[model samples]
Target: MLLWRFVGRTNVILSNGVNWQRHSRVVKSALNRNVPIEKFASLTKRLFSVMGDGGRLLTFSTTLTEASRFILCLLSGTTALGHDFNTIVDNHSPFVAKYNEVMDSIASPLFLVFPKLETWFPRKHVIRKIDDLVNDFGKLLEDKKQRPGNDMLTYMLEEPEMTDEEFRDNMVVFFIAGHDTTAGAMSSFVYYLSKHPEAQVRARKEVVAALGKDEPNIENLRHMPFLQACIRESLRINTPIVSCLSLMVILSPILRAIIPDLCSNGKSYHIPAKASVIMNICAIHYNETYWPNPYKFDPTRFMNQGDGEEARIDASLWLPFALGPRQCPARNFAMYELRTLASMLLQQWEWNLPADSPHHDSIKNGFSPFALSLPKDMDIIFRRVEQ
Candidate 1:
């Protein structure tokens, strides 16, 4: 009920069967077509301009969160809706504010604990705001119909069976997924890099060697193996989403009879006809069996050993983007964004945690109303690198 209130039931993330196929096909194609590297580069440059040069102590958690939101809002808006939110310049954009409000309301601990209270004592104001946001999406769809462009909405309109509600719901899902989660991941990257100067130095060296005074492109990003390892390690140590949404599966009677048990970690349990299973991402990522000294921030685990040997870790163990066909459709896009931004930061500045900062020992988790795990009050001292 809470999720439906936010993204509705028809978005690609939660939808099933033919509906899922249709939504996934269009979303994946749109994301594949639009890489947005130039957009990310330009926006990041603007962000640097806003931050200014020189040795400055900046609060990274706030800065990165806002920058990520602005960049992603523009990216998702332009690609999916053929609109520019202009949130980077105008921080108080009405649409963005309303969207944030809706997300916060959905993440309210009170409502989450007692979901029935929402039904019994309805928050009419929040409901009205949600409806208003949907109506705003409806307006965007109408505008696209009159003035079609090379965007996802234009492509989705080609589907005869698609509904307006489905389109709006998917847009909300894209906004939530592309904005906050990526922001949290970026925060984790900075937190890890700040705490470990060795990893940061190695990553910067690779970035500089690959593309000195040049903008990062897809080919250049591919060559930064150490930087890639840093990203993977950061993701493993602090997965953005601690736990995925519950996945409910209905088992057939015949199948249940044939396979009456499910096994995990040398333990077996009888299966019921229907069960809601939630994947605890944090537990798997930190499991001692899979990762040695799991709490340690070591990027070498992902690095290739000497003599062209590949890392022997199982691919399934890494579930930051999840696994299987239902994996995030925008995985490539998100990775490119991360790599590009990280490269830009490395090229322009050398940053470390402030002497008086609280995160000297460990990265503190921020309070997020949503599923994302964020770094709290991260203040990094950045020195501009001489060209």
Candidate 2:
């Protein structure tokens, strides 16, 4: 309830265009200019080089997790930390510790609901540790202020409308949301690629054709159809934000916050006045109403245009990143990382699993009853494609 008052519904931008203008500008400028992709290419290259080694690898493996941690730390540095993307990330021990700790433990939120029993339980440490790590971030931000020029944090601090408390909340939102969702969703992308060989092959062909021996840039990235389809597929199958709503929020001082997706097309979803309501992602995503053969893992479905069957699955059914005003400000940021990582993998390596391994579709608390969908413990072997 408290959080909702601050950020509103995740879909507010979609519904109230006029009111959303400033927030949109702030987010766009923050992501595009402040955290421009150029700063992080070195890290991408480093990761790509590792992919070229043809060594066996797996998602969330200690080594892979460490590499992922560095990339994510770099990502946060540019956006939330607002430091030299390279330097800040390497030196930020607290961030590395926080992120590494977050990854190592995935007890879920039961601890929050059961604090008393947490001590006697296994997951309690995760909560206590995460709280400590958040403090570590607070210190990092404080240290940045006395140092020098303003970065992302500095930019927010300059906002005349934002209070110190609001700024801190946004920071917490950044660290928690930024670290977990991006890495987790991308992990899903990797695991899906490993499990779905046909899609992987087709996706590589598209990457090679679109970027074709050229380094990935924002301009060229727009043309990669297969790569985009793979990303869309990964996001669709594993939505990062399971559900969202602003039903209880008011519009004016008189009426509460306006409901998003209010009477879309002709259908109206009843939103109780002054009550928290949610939009079920999986329900809408996998609904046969929107997607034909919804259960199938087919990226081509997104590419299909001529056939009406494929047309149904078009864009409507996919909601990996929730839509509207409060949607992820870092959608493109996350996508760039996913696409770059994926293209490099497909272009340079062929991934496989142990013959005895079973294809596990991941089991994090997701959609209907829990947190976002995630895939973990996925192991794969890579054979380098010789130049």
> Please, what is the whole-model Cα lDDT of each candidate in the order they appear?
0.78, 0.58
User: Candidate 1 lDDT, tens digit per residue, 61-151?
Assistant: 3444565667667666765577778776787888888888887777778888788998999988888888888788778878888998877
Q: 62-98, model 2: which lDDT tens digit per residue?
A: 2233345456656666556665335222545655565
TM-score of 1: 0.90
Per-residue lDDT of 104 in model 2: 45
Query: TM-scores for all candidates?
Result: 0.90, 0.72
Clashing pairs in 1: none
Off by over 4 Å in 2: 1-25, 32-35, 49-70, 78-80, 83-94, 99-132, 146-151, 154-158, 249-271, 304-316, 360-370
